[model samples]
Target: MTTTQSLPHWNMDVVYPGLQSPEFAQGFAATVKEIEALVQLFDASHVEKQDVLTVDDGLIKTFETAVEHFNSVQDHVLTLEVYISCFVSTNSRDEVAQARESELENSLVKLSQLDTRFTAWLGSMDVEQLIAHSEVASAHAYALRRAKAESLHMMSPREESLASELNVSAGTAWTKLHANLTSQLNVTLELDGQTQQVPMSVVRNQASSTDREVRRRAFEAELAAWKEVAVPLAQALNSIKGEVNTLAHKRQWESALDASLFANSIDRQTLDAMLSAARASFPDFRRYFRAKAQALKIPQLAWYDIFAPLGSSDRVWEYSDAERFIVEQFGTFSERLSNYAARAFSEGWIDAEPRAGKRDGAYCTPLRKDESRIFTNYKASFDGVSTLAHELGHGYHNLNLAERTALQSFLPMTLAETASIFCETIINHAAMKDADREERMAILEASIQGACQVVLDITSRFLFEQNVFEQRKQRELSVEELNGLMLQSQRDTYGDGIDQQTLHPYMWAVKGHYYSSDLSFYNYPYMFGLLFGLGLYARYQQNPEAFKQGYDELLSSTGLDDAATLAARFGIDLHSEAFWRGSLDIVRQDIDAFCELVQSQA
Candidate 1:
């Protein structure tokens, strides 16, 4: 009965009328006041601050009130930032959006120091003693414990403050420049005796074309575009990593990876275990890749051909049809998830159209209180449909945790993909079940393609970034050196599975991961999420009833515990190579089935 034709754009009017709106002015002024209030609360000279900090007769009441005010201020600041982000993402050429974004960044420059001091002070408190006597303490007990654990490496408040202020111009500016260059850069793809200028987003999406010629041309064009801008991007990567290395040293952390581990609420042992398993499982992955090459009638799979479509899986989905299908498919798993998808579609919570100046990738931004906005370049493909499911999965996760306090809602990135991947799996499985043989082959090929990207490609990224953090400490690397590093990483991870001559040497220049100073090694988390999510899916298959019982708790507890501890609650061992190896076993089985189908039909 629905007559929706075009994809839904997000309603930012509810957040603010516009950047020039008086409502925005009021929120900005209020935020400034709140920031000052929270910052002054941590000032030791203030008598009321001392009384509020101490465990006195009125300490519980005052401290609870203070935390509420702090959260309110943080929320307002974030709301404003999200508005700018949403606007700038959709209209990258809007200088006003970018300016306001920078203004908000400047306005909140004091946040880091304030937050560090507050967490450090909270760490110093008798959290157990306070929790026993205060209801508010009971609510934020885990966050306090986590803050105490993280405070082990807290720099002097002044030092932390200096680092925060320094990053504004140093790391932040470099990243914005990188973003600006990539978003605006156009790629010229020559095809069918004609050349077309397109955004990098569209050019990259062409890698999934069923036509081998188109895919190859798109890949070459993408590399050429990146080559033109690689030098500055190389410098950006070096400066960002160099800054992180310097900051990590100042904080007295053992390594940048150690700091990243702490931020992800995971430990080194788990990372080693995870990587070890991934490395050992490559034989199965190679088998899948080789089968894909066979399906494509190629002797060896070229890097450009990695996403080349195989079989008769050329179904182009309409946006509205995808919305309905995804909602119904989600119901197969949980009514709650299905309901969330329904709400997202009925309400305007998605921006799913390709446009000039729009960002390249898709993401779900969970706002607050059962609301989220999904951004995607939805071109009406099954893959786009799957992406919609993935993002909505994240929204559903947010919905489940909506009742938690602000601090408790800050889940680590490692577990952030759980619900999203789970939802994707559900939709993929449902599609495969109802699909014909050739379509089924396409589904299997698509699944393995995704696995390869996460497991193998992400491994290469982690290695490349780790090496850069080590080398950039000594000196800046040139564009040629960065390319060389990327080539070697691709070769090491892909081995002979990918065509050596056609490997993408400019991948480091194109990836957004290399530029994040705080979020170093953003690569391996994808591998972790993909495999771990499959492992959870396998468990659900075996015992849907029992698995469903603890699923809610698992998602809700993500912000409260370390990755290892949280997995342990579900009887999964994150520190064991066996656990991860077992997870990949699911992929191994899928490869077996896919290869069998290809050979059977050949």
Candidate 2:
């Protein structure tokens, strides 16, 4: 197993050696001065409701210049803070180090004021005049439109600024509390005639144990531990959602989903289509779940039982072996992806190891001026290899978009999954091709296990979030009410496949995605990304030579256009159910082969 020592060396010194550096001082002072100047130019009386279309050439040019400068300064400062905080988080455990983190947090909190001022100024622009500014009209037109849409949800500038600041102490603080409680909560799992304190991550992974007794124990202990903190966490979630709803009402918006979707830059039509496809695909999911339950010899599968091993195959790859396997598989599909993965490993780009005090889970952060950075906790298991592919896919996506400006390089949630899922598909396809019968069973089970989580499990989360919003409008949700809603959502999605008695009721409290104040309906985007990526992968399989170029072009163009246009380049129509069904058909084919393979073994 890889340890914390294998993580990337934090290189904040590349920006500046310390806060005392001349570069840091100059950049910090310059950003503050610039923000003050922009605030002074916000002529509230004349600018209110004045569209950029009607603004004179001089004023328009001035506005454009101010925006560019403001964005540039804001991006640089925010990026620097992120780099520093990540460094601090990875290394510092002492009080002084923590105090330094507090300082950075406070500074970032203060900068939230500038965010409100800028948004209000942008909102104050006359619709036509803003649209008519040639510079703004030509480039980043989508961003400009999105800003205007979001601004429509704003209250008076004063209230908006207060909300921005209060969020630091409200939703943000409660989430921090939840993080602390969960990380420190230990489940005293009785194993091997001894009591051992198990972390949540270890307990969750135990559900994959080939030993049924172990999984049952882990599952029971895991949920039991949550009872200790579920009440406070429930309060945290309800409070945050309440604020989101009230803010939406104040802005005269129709719903929280509408505001969130606008920020996500997706439309209701696409969301509805995605949910419909997920619902329609339940039969395929149920088939796989039933097969697994039979294979495991269980009367009925429970939530953790869904990950129960179907075969006694145990194949472990070392870290280097995992890397080589991923790169080779990715290369087989596309040289572009292979080359990116190779560079990510050869260069000091990947932080592919687990460590104490490091944040759990995996992510790939792309630095506009430098190479992308990948983080993961590797346990030398099959899932770890899949994680490597997933994160490297993100790195490759970043590499493809490296030439674009930072503002233009950011892809929305819908299309962000394309490169990542393509990478995963390449690995899964290769495994299916090369593995022996037992190995194939393991790999297929793993893939299906993950897919069900992304599709079926995510569907439950979507339903739960929807119900929470509806009930929240009436009144706040107590812990008991919240748990009931969660179980209902799971039952709806899992149906007869999952035993209701053993379903995870603390799911909403554990998932951090629900706590986000900004991103509502975050659940469905996973299904959209996965199915969309599968559709693209299917196209690539048909004509590898021709489609490879098209795939690369699609990724490069993702930042430049909306999801629909970007997908259309690959002959995909986001609006059509047929398109999503075509993608699900590919997964169905996999499930078919895996079923036959398992039956032959029996």
- Give per-residue CA lDDT, model 1, range 10-69, as digits (tens): 888877798889998887777777787776775632312112255665666656876786
Q: What is the C-alpha RMSD of each candidate to the true structure, in Å?
A: 2.7, 3.3
> Residues 1-602, candidate 2, lDDT per residue (tens digit)?
22322434434565556656788667656655655564555443232233343456765776666556656655665555565555544433334444545555555554566555555556666645666656664565665555566677678867876887787777776666665556556677877778898666666667777778888998899888888888889988888888888988998889888876665556888778777877898988888887887778778888878777654246665777777899888878767778878877777666654444545566777754436777776655677788789888887887787765555665777777778888988887787786777878888887887788888999999899989988899898988899999999999999988887988899997787788776677787778888988988888878888897677777777767778877777788888888887888877787887778767766
> Model 2 — TM-score against the truth?
0.90
Candidate 2 deviant stretches above 4 angstroms: 1-53, 84-102, 105-137, 191-193
lDDT of 2 at 208: 70
How many residue pairs clash in all the candidates, one count each?
0, 11
